[model samples]
Target: MIETLTRIPVAHYSNLKARAGYSIKIDKTEIALFKVTNGEVYALENRSPHPKGGVLSEGLVSGNYVYCPVYDWKISLVDGTVQAPDEGKVQTYQVEIKENIIFIVL
Candidate 1:
């Protein structure tokens, strides 16, 4: 079956910087947008799997992973997978940047 996606504009490219991320709410879900060190952007669920808190947007971003601020769980920004040595995962959203505008596929 084919999946239908809704692309929603979240922010402008200039508002996001390298190695940092921003959090926004979509209905009841908290979405985090990150501009990785490689100049590419990624989107993930803002909640950390360690039960620490929903602070993935404020976590320490190093390369492709963001270390949870409360419990130090390393989460991969590329796919929202909790790094090995840890057990859970968050949701990864498909992202598109067109003409410097960021859009998240839902």
Candidate 2:
């Protein structure tokens, strides 16, 4: 059965990394949070869509996309859509920022 997701506050700009990863709790779920841009945080499934690898929180950001470190696959930072060659899309979470604090809706 599909379960409902919960939104949880993750961090602030002082604690967030530029295109890095951090974990947060959302309805008892251990979520992987990514701070992709300033004032624009992108949330995605911790697991990568291409093969079985990490979701690439540390993946290189070129333009508006990130490249998965595993197979060098580029995933869209804005929507988590699989870019080009890659197939399937990873889950994406709604992100909102307030007072420099990052909030994510899993």
Question: Alpha carbon lDDT of residue 3, candidate 2?
Answer: 86
Q: Write down the lDDT of every candidate, Cα atoms only.
A: 0.89, 0.70
lDDT of 1 by residue, 1-106 (tens): 9989999999998889888879988888899889987789999988898856658999989999998988899999987788889889999999999998999999
Which pairs in model 2 have colliding backbones?
A: none
Which segments of model 2 are wrong by more than 4 Å? 1-6, 25-30
Provide the TM-score for each candidate, comma-separated. Answer: 0.92, 0.74
Each candidate structure's count of clashing pairs = 0, 0
Instruction: List the lowest-lDDT window of 10 residues for candidate 1.
Output: 46-55
lDDT of 2 by residue, 11-52 (tens): 785687666766566665555666656535677776677656
Superposition TM-score, candidate 1 onto the true structure: 0.92
